[model samples]
Target: MPDDRVEVEEEPVSETRLSLTADCGSCFGLCCVALPFTASADFAINKEAGKPCRNLREDFGCGIHTQLRQKGFNGCTVYDCFGAGQHLSQGTFGGTDWRREPKSAQQMFEVFPVMRQLHELLWYLNEALTLAPAKPVHADLRELLARTEALTGGSAEELARLDVPGHRQQVNLLLLRTSELVRAQVPGKKRNRRGADLIGAKLRKAELRGADLRGAYLIAADLTGADLRDADLIGADLRDAQLAGADLTGAFFLTQPQVNAAKGDPSTRLPGRLTRPAHW
Candidate 1:
């Protein structure tokens, strides 16, 4: 029941100025090449790790970029790299591309996944620092943020050798504390459903304000018109969940990929930072 949702998807939400936002143009298609996918509901074909996706273009763009979902690549539409691609391409590897520098390809692929985890942590820590309810840990969060940010700047070899999970555990500790502080401010008793198996459960118009749904499986749940203000949704699987008319204002740690996987309409209120998914 742990928050494995963090590792399930990597793409950062678009339409945000957040440092973790994925700008594919600034990247070298690391996700397309460094990560593998299997033919499933999310992907259209089975690809081996470290192999470039056939849809990848010569300039590191997806040839089917505009039609990913249409082409059975639903995963590509929601998968985010948390800006790790650009950070590695332009900063860590100094614009050295895998295709151009065949020798560095394997090394770059190895370092990408590691760098991605670091950047994901950065995104969460940055979010924690912004919550006034979590102000008690602001100073500590800033320190952790600085440390994680510094890790992202390490050399490719250093990044490849990084103990990412160990570092993630260290970061998770403070994040847990931050979540407690923020949720404590809720008026009524907050529901503790961390990592609950609520897949396809009927939760229509549920009062889940300030709920702790971290890593919860909400797949296909009917959450229409639910009040989810100030909820912690880090790593929550929301695929095909009914969010029509749901209000998620002030929800923390909810990423774009989660939103993309859910079904919503114009009436579905989202946090200020997240835009309505194109498919919705």
Candidate 2:
């Protein structure tokens, strides 16, 4: 049976201020309108892309803000806007509420997602640069960070017209470099099992903490009851990875959406922000 009594801690809003990152509260609820969600694995309802969610209030706040999960909208709880939604909705657009400015609403909505992507990249790029082992790529990191930040600060029109995929490609290059630097410091023969076909591997109760299993094809691996504390699961393809009773506490760089996209049973352990996999 699942321990329903185990309380999940909410992410402290104050953690956003510790870094020079995007501030979601400063902007209006742009993501609610700009991004579309479908009744897929992540969302419980079929929402058209670019349509405002039914829970979004006229003032641009979430109607289900406090009771998101209880209302079957748990996906909203794990999403972090990196402050770009508010920045574009309020700062760059001069506090013009999208509802009141009907003509500009479409443009505002379009630009919101673009800025969100840029800000998300900034978040990951900033995190990559913080690794001590990535010192050799410090100069490149600095340059990329500056460029990404500047792109986020562009006008709504400019942001809407921006080639976000190109920028993402550039950041991916830096991430590749950072990965190499970190893994080179690992004092062991590089695991040939990387990106290996590990579907249905009996890794139950295994201790894989702090392991470099990047980009490993771990589809359908029976990781039940495994200890993955502080694991570097970046780029690990965990589609269908059996996480029943597995402990993923403190797994670094593990995104909520990515975890939500996987399959897990009720006994699965997850980071605080995510609920048990809905498909479990």
In the range 1-280, model 2's lDDT, one tens digit per residue, is 2211222233322212223344555666776777778775557787876688998887677888777767777567556666676677666888888677788888887787787777677666666655567778878877888888788778878887899889888988887677666545544444434466677788888877545566677877888898775456666777667787888864544665557545677777776744564546
Which portions of model 2 show Cα errors greater than 4 Å?
1-24, 189-202, 207-232, 235-252, 256-280
Please write out the lDDT profile of model 1 over residues 137-171, one tens digit for every residue: 87888888888888888898889888998999999
Least accurate 10 contiguous residues by lDDT in model 2: 1-10
Cα deviation of 86 in candidate 2 (Å)? 1.5
- Model 1 segments more than 4 A misplaced: 1-18
**Residue 280 lDDT in candidate 1:** 85
lDDT of each: 0.86, 0.67
Model 2 lDDT, full chain set: 0.67
Could you tell me which residue pairs clash in candidate 1?
10-80, 11-79, 11-80, 11-81, 12-80
